[model samples]
Target: MAKHHYKVGQTVSGITKGYTSEGLGILYTEDNSRFFVKGLIDGEEAEAKITYVGQRSSYAKLTKLITKSDKRIQPKCPVSTACGGCQFQHIAYDEQLKIKRGIVENAFRTIAKSDHPVDECVASPMPYYYRNKMQIPLGLDKKGNIISGFYRARTHIIIPTPECVIENERSNGIIATIRALMKSMRIPPYDEDKRSGVIRHILIRTSYYTPGLMVVLITNADNFYSRNNFVKALTKAHPEITTVVQNVNKRKTSVILGKRFRTLYGPGFIEDDILGIRFKISPQSFFQINPLQTENLYKIAIEKAEINNSHTVLDAYCGIGTISLIAARHAKKVIGVEINSRAIRDARSNANRNNIDNVEFYTADASDFMENEAKLGSKYDVVIMDPPRKGSDEKFLNAVLTLEPKKVVYVSCNPGTLARDITLLNKKYEIKSITPVDMFSQTYHVETVVLIERK
Candidate 1:
């Protein structure tokens, strides 16, 4: 390997040209080499010290802002720089929308090689305090005291946070109560290195449209000493809590939840309303974290679907029938497929609870289900897919091409993968419109809804 052009601890100043995929501002040095700097906005001249020198690009920490951009603002959170939770907190909200739109447009142009237009990102109604769910890791601070907060960027070290601005406000009190209970009860935070200790993580979920909250205590062992007392204390302190669950995970893994769950209070689940439809969210269910933005995203997807009483819809990777049930109200029939059995069970129960008979759910891989459906000559007038951040694979795209749905609606979290998948499907479908939604306001993540029609 050759020596890097930029040396560690060296300071340089340049104008920020643009943002990288990870939301870091990109600056070009005099030698035309790139440096990725944190806490910067486009069109700003900044001085930064090189932290890490890589083969292609160097990483830097912003030392001083010589010329600040108009989009810069004072971050609300005190630990925004070190928390690594929100990347665009320093940038204005309106400018964040434009940056996200540019991200999507660049992905389409560079990855998909398509000149399709991407509209401005739809702003969230409530940017701060909009998150309905939080999974906080429990660990010991420097003094060996129990602490609860999110992990620092690219490290296991926990950044003690008594409050997070993006998460639901009610969660702060709940977490504080749980942390105090654990400390009083002498419950040790799980040590990943030793694979020992008691409490691992605390998962909290709240409802925006209903008065209910669910707490799941993830532990290293099934036995939680005086678990009943803990539950009672939580419920007494927070009357809004409707359910409490204890999940066990003995294996030394990074995954949060375990296979077995023991309900300590209520129905082991909490109910929430989305677009007037009730959904039972359990400890393991994959529901949207932001309810306000979810409603907006679903409305756009449903509108782009153009569902009618005469249409049949296929919802791929449908988690808990959130989208399928919503579409059933406007479509004749809807079939939802998911790989997780727990999600499928919740989906079935939700459909029945909503008294929706036009929708059915199956537990299977989305691509496999679509492939088998194509072989069976089953046709769907509309197809709706909300895939994971990795987006759809080639097999799924091939199956979609075979089905030849009149209209396809794609809900994507990662624009890069979305562009790649769209390119694969472009062989049979033509892009109509792409609308970006601000699902995660402060973070670099953005949700996009795209509509495509058969060519």
Candidate 2:
């Protein structure tokens, strides 16, 4: 990192760009070469400071937007840009969908064009308050006061938020209660720089199946407070909270979950119902943030899978068996593979609760499972994958190709990685159609469903 030379009020010309990870950063110039910014968008002139000067590209921070984009809107949340939870809150909701659509199309044209051209991007029906889970980080200000909020983008520094627009009113109320508790207890907030703290983060999950909420406290010290007092306070304050647990995370890392967790109150899990399917989700389980949009996404994925009584489907990265249970109704057998044993257990429990006997879940890496299954001469008619934002690995893509499934319904959050994998699979599959679903409203992130048929 070099001394930021680009001062405020300095006008610099740059191009607007859209990348997979780094949101719309500005493409500036220095020494007659191009330098890109990380926290900027297109068509906006900003008084920015060059944070880093690298061999290829430089990073800059926006100080002032001299000329803003027409799509820019008054961010609903007070801590919009600072909060890492969302990326496109400053842009208009309608424009956010449009930009996400462009992101999906660009990925197809650039990475998966050899297969078949993408037709249109599907826009999400609802944009706000779609999130079902929210993790709030606990931090301290300069005065050593507790500040429970979200981290700033690309930084561990906590941006204290009075209210979050993405979270539900119930979830937000939990946040408020936690804040009040911290103030009442007068506990020292976590200090990232000094590495001395108590509470690190708070995890909350809610569903319609349960009357109470699930609360997990992540902390370093073991003797922070009496477990009885903590649980008693929480139970009295919020009786709807049927579950509460304390997660011990001593390591100085950014990840939420740690190695050990202890139940402080009620059961160790919460139940979430989806399309008549019931699932048990723990603190570590991976579920979709937006439940309503997820219904739409799953509907599209199941439809594309083309389930029948005779068909066998494979659901890869099937967290809590959300798709497996749904597909089980139509398919003779649905096999779901996941890396997390916790999620696998949840999926199995979900299947049993839903009375879907046709689905089987395994706690193994999907790519490895598929490879071994292929060697054993097993095959599936339809394969559905919902990978992380980085997309599927090369090995997974190759396994799917080798198996030669009749159809593949690929759901992706990151368009670039999805495009790259789709390009590899294009050798044996024809790109049938692409639909972009706007799950996170007021955010640049888009969920895309790509339908591919055997060539």
The residue-by-residue lDDT of candidate 2 on 104-216, one tens digit each, is 77767776664355544555555666676788888767786677778787787789888888886577777777767777776655676788867778888877555647898
For each candidate, give its TM-score against the true structure.
0.97, 0.90
Q: Candidate 1's residue-wise lDDT over 136-194, tens digit each?
A: 99988788888988888888778888899999999999999888888988778899998
Which lDDT values do the candidates have, in the order given?
0.91, 0.77
- Model 1 residue runs over 4 Å out of place are 1-4
Q: lDDT, candidate 1, residue 377?
A: 86
Model 1 vs. true fold: TM: 0.97
Candidate 1, position 112, lDDT? 90
